[model samples]
Target: MQKLLIIDDNDEVRRQLKWGLSKGGYELTFARDGVEGLNMFKKQEPSVVTLDLGLPPHENGVEEGLRCLGEMLRINPLSKIIVITGNEEHGAALKAVQGGAYDYYKKPIDLNELKIIIDRAMYLQTLEQENQDLRDSSVADCGIVGECGTMQEVFTLIDRVAASDVPVLITGESGTGKELVARAIHAKGPRADKDMVCINCGAIPENLLESELFGHEKGAFTGANRTVKGKVEYAEKGTLFLDEIGEMPMSLQVKLLRFLQEMVITRVGGRRDIEVDVRIIAATNVDIQEAMQNGTFREDLFYRIGVVNIVLPPLRDRGADIALLANYFLKRVSAGAGSRGKAFSPEALEYINGYDWPGNIRELENRVKRAVIMATGPQIEPDDLGINGGDVLRQRLHANDLSLKEARMLLERDMVEDALKRESGNIVKAAASIGVSRPTFYDLMKKHGVRNA
Candidate 1:
């Protein structure tokens, strides 16, 4: 049942609202003052709250009531708080509304009218909650699964930048799912209904890159038989994803910058300047700074498309997300392949956690798919994943025949040392790679008597 919290100090007022709002099909809770009301609000987590501005110990003033309203809203910003006030305190009622109250009710409340407002507020709150849930679910379904802090930060950035029309530049190492991030932004944005045109800047030859982006008129080139639209034209009213944008030829960068600045494009061998509205999302595996310094990439164009930059971390640095993604991929690939479902063996899981994924998520997914196809047994082994002898921790633990606590201590120390070695003794990078804070990493190093070179 929907919860309704009534925060009026007056005994008669609370009774009246309780009786009237009870008929609205709600679970009603009442508080005589702001403190009690806030406590009830937190406990009940009511979708709708009816706050009385004339609350004690200064019932004649609206300070206590306003304070309660602010605190409740702070706890749950989506809370629908309806403020009740006296006819003489019209200004206070307005002030309450300005302070984020859902609505304001005046003196001499009519039960039916107040019920209507309360019902509306409850309905809107339900809708907002549903929308939030849908967004969260959609993001998960997009194959960008990760629970690590860095991945969570990337997800937050995707949500924030998806709502705007500004150009986005995604940078990461090769096979780190830069394109996946781009697609997530496009899929969640307002332009999702429209086509998301994609073009790989590096995959295409330099001689034809311009024609591919800006279209070519009939007979413009040796093989031009008819006029054709380009990727930018097809992406009108939508998004254009330029994969490997760092590889875009310097000659074409000036043209892309022009179109970005003016929102107009001219086809090859065509005189007409076509105005196309499209958001640009570019991704690259190259270091953009180095490219710019070498004069291979334009600095102005970089700033133009990189209004917001989303940098994806390498898979090795994402800690436990490596195992999380591996399992996620196994389940998905196995299901898609019409298999009864396959799991990773303990040794395989250990290997997955231990091995460095230089190729990032792309490499993990490919290995999982290959394993599903190659494995004859129900559980995939490290050999099936093509990573032989990677489970050193598992082997070491089994060989020693140590107690559970000893095994755990040994595993922790080995993981710390391995991460440090993989990261070349960079404490910050090593700590983050193993999903621990720098201080915790330091403690582990001290506990194990491990020295860094």
Candidate 2:
């Protein structure tokens, strides 16, 4: 129920207004003076407030009433305040409206009219609150639950770039929260009020990619039954996010570049050029530079889109963030599943931190979501996480068996072997494949006394 505050120095008037409003299905609170009204406003956070011009200790005056209105607005800018004034105090009521009152009423209050005004004010306040909540909930650093140094740097970069109009290129492994970062930029940017259209270049077929980027006129092709605006046109004066841009076909690259350069596009089978003011934000997991060299992606397009690049570090490299992300996801998943308060067991947290996490943040979220649903107890164990409970038990049994150097050597050996397999034993490719420089790869091989295959 919506809450309403009625402030009047006259006891009879306050009681009457409170009774009438309460009968209309509103949660009502009454204050006998301007000071009491401000106190009640702070404590209850009512949606709407009605203040009488004649206030206690300053009766037959508008000074105290106007002061209360200003204080209420400062506490909650979106609050709706209706000022009540006597017939002779019309000037004061007009001044109150100019002072940010929602609406004013003459004395000898009409209960019916007052009810209508209050209802409208309550509706507007509710809408504003909901919009603010959605804006707060959509951001990553704001909603993503991480305080690691790496995450802090990421947040700082987002804050810096959100105020500019420069194109942003987000590059990271799949499921490393690329889209979340993109959303943070859009939500905090100047174009936040406009649409943020998203297009997955890899998901669409090559034959349709061009038409998707730039709209088509009626009968442009076999399936072009009607004219349709493309993603770029639809996002005019807003933001357009192109995901997996590395997968965009070469045929469409020229068209995209033309659009970027000219800030205009002609629909397929149409002659008139349409102009747009769109900010482009592209993301990808693949090596776009490699694609450029391999004759698949265009070099000019790469330079154009990568003016401001943000390479997100994968979850494994982001030490200790695994636990943070796990806890964050656990809360969300537990609430969604309607389960009892769920938390990760000590063993489960250890296994999560120790895992390679090749799939990055996305994989961790999925594991936690599943665990929340599958766990029988309040505390989720390693077994529920599907991380090989036997391995955990064996490690605990031999906790003092391995030296620090031996443990480090074993991990290094596994990583090098995996990198070699993934890169087909090419040292250069293996180095890039494992996200390490060539010098670092060579040093690791020598340290572990492994032969270059």
lDDT of 2 by residue, 192-235 (tens): 99999999999999988888888899999998899999999999
Model 1 residue runs over 4 Å out of place are 1-140, 390-453
Model 1 scores a C-alpha lDDT of 0.86
Which regions of candidate 2 are displaced past 4 Å? 1-142, 389-453
lDDT of each: 0.86, 0.82
Top-scoring candidate (lDDT) = 1
lDDT of 2 at 22: 71
Error of model 2, residue 319, in angstroms: 1.3
Which 10-residue span in candidate 1 carries the lowest summed lDDT?
388-397
- Model 1: per-residue Cα lDDT over 273-336, one tens digit each: 9999999999999999999999999999999999999999999888888887886777668658
